[model samples]
Target: MNLENLRREYLKGGLHRDQLADDPIVQFERWMTQIIATNIPDPNAMTVATVDADGQPSQRIVLLKGLDQRGFVFYTNLRSRKAQDLKHNPRISLHFPWHCLERQVKVCGIAEPLSAAESLKYFVSRPRESQLAAWASQQSRPISSRSMLLQQFEAMKNKFGKGEIPLPDFWGGYRVKPQRIEFWQGGVHRLHDRFQYTRQADDSWSIERLEP
Candidate 1:
């Protein structure tokens, strides 16, 4: 496949200062609404990047389960590899690449575990099979075979026995309260539009343009 031959103009849109919301959160919500309106597949998907204890970097795509004015929230097993990385270094980054729309948003922040009650609420809303799988999966741990996972799932099923499946102590949600949020819009000849909102000491935001 010749990658260079596949270039198509990124004429989907443009962003201007006059059109941007003064508040970054509101600006983000507007873009989110546009994504939703365009009916892009899995618009909530984001790449979560973390650094391990040894300063090694890793990243993977995760669904954006929840968000609010405070921060962006995602859930996973606290014992997973990414969770271990967060345990060592709470500073994290998230990227949303809406390629079809030629747009992206990057965020960096400190990650902190959400309240236990919040975790339980989301856990209870999940399907029964997912709940059992949550209990069965020893995330980031070595396992011998697929049969072993099935066995564990069956065991967990029996243990719960049509009862409430308690949220595992090792599983929960984390929110990344953004200190910096950058919005990127692909433009002609790679002259992209980049605007970043940096949090200030007084809980205000300072917006700036970045060289692209």
Candidate 2:
């Protein structure tokens, strides 16, 4: 397995300090807007990492449902593995792997559950089937097979019966209040550009460049 031959040069453009916004959220939205315009699939998808109480780390891809100065928001079943980990330890990390643009963003933050009102608002906006699926899936829990899961979904459909699917008691969203965020852009010769924004006590961001 001598697989060292799988590397490619990142010839994309470089990021400069002058181009960065004072607010990381603004910078993030700028990048997000660009990526969305490119029609790339699931540009809002991000990798969320959390550690259990026993110190075991886990990672999974989740959609970025909402974003603003408050933080990045995502929804899931409260019983899910990631949700359980967040319960044990609210500290969390998120990564946006926009490799097509040779850029990425990393965030370290504290995870806080979104209010029930907020969760319900977002939940109702979802497609009916997705809303039903949320009710059917136990998320991190085990299932016997696809047929059983489908049966559960079918049961939910029949129970709801063209009526509005209520938000499940165990389903909700979490917002990651970022304490530190880093934006990285690939450069020629591997001299990548990296800038980090750390939140100050005054609630302002302090930006600095780091070695590639």
Candidate 3:
């Protein structure tokens, strides 16, 4: 497979330092708004990377549940691999790949569990079916077969039987408090534009442009 010529020129646009918002969170929201306006599928989908106790790393795609000054938030089974990893090591990274816009946002931070009240608030907003499924699946665990999984789902459906499903004890959300964030915009001739925002000791952000 001689596939050395698989590439496309990024002529969409170029990013200027002046165009960036003073606050990275504000800039992230602006970019997110543009992405949502377009037809791009799952605009909030992001790659979350975590490391195990042994220092081995793992990555997975998760939907962004909430975002604010506190930081980015996502929910998952508290007993999942990612959750276990976070328990051992809070350090984590997140990457948003907005390929259609030729833009990317990389975030590095520590993962902290959201309050039970906060988790329950989002849990109740989920669809009934999703709520039931959340109880049935033991994420990151091996399953016997598809039939067995569906059986568990069916069992949960019957148990709930039109009643509001409660939040699973082993399920909740995590907030990533970002220490650093980098925004990248693809440019022609492989000269990309990159700007990084680092959190200062006084909670202020120090922005710097990095060479591509």
Candidate 4:
């Protein structure tokens, strides 16, 4: 199969500077709302990129659990590779690929661990099976077999039978305080429209257009 032949032109509507909100967060929220309205699969899914102490970069898809003025939030096991990387270096990047809309958003920021109380609040809201799975699995660690994993899951289910499953001490969330955000809208002939918001000293944002 010739992979180079796979190509499609994007002709989605262009993004204008006048359409941008003064705050990047607000603009992001608007885009998210549109995506959600379209019934897109896993609209909250985002690619999180982190760098290790050795300068090796790793990326994975993580659900955007919460978003507000603070920034983007996602959860994972504290001992996971990504978590460990963030522990050593808080700098991280996030990418939201809204391909159906021919748009994407990129965020660069510092990741900070969410408070225990905040993590607990979201944990309890998750489905019971997911809660149990969280307790059973050691994320990013090698396991023996499928049966062993199921056995652990069953054991956790029984342990928390007929009661609330407490949040795992090792499982929690991180908030990425974005220092820069870029919104891209694909245009005809591959000439995309790109606008970037850079954080200012007064916590405001300065918007700039980038040549595509």
Instruction: Count backbone overlaps in model 2.
Output: 0
1-212 in candidate 4: lDDT tens per residue? Answer: 89998989988789999999999999999999999999988999999999999999999999999999999999999999999999999999999999999999999999999999999999999989999999999999999899999999999999989898998999999999999999999998999999999999999999999999
lDDT, residue 29, model 4: 96
lDDT of each: 0.92, 0.96, 0.95, 0.96
RMSD of 4: 0.8
After superposing candidate 3 on the true structure, give the runs of residues whose Cα lies further than 4 Å from its correct spot: none
Cα lDDT for residue 207, candidate 3: 92
Give lDDT: candidate 4, residue 193: 97
How far is 7's C-alpha from truth in model 3 (Å)?
1.0
Q: Candidate 2, residues 91-113: lDDT per residue as tens digits?
A: 99999999899999999999999
What's model 3's lDDT at 148?
A: 96
Error (Å) of candidate 1 at residue 174 is 0.5
lDDT of 4 at 163: 95
| Per-model RMSD to reference | 1.4, 0.8, 0.8, 0.8
TM-score of each: 0.94, 0.98, 0.98, 0.98
**What tens-digit string does per-residue lDDT give for candidate 1 at 1-212?**
77878777677667777777878889988888889888978999999999998889999999998878899999999999999999989999999998878999999999999999999999999999999999999988999999999999999999999998999999999999999999999888778889999999987999998988
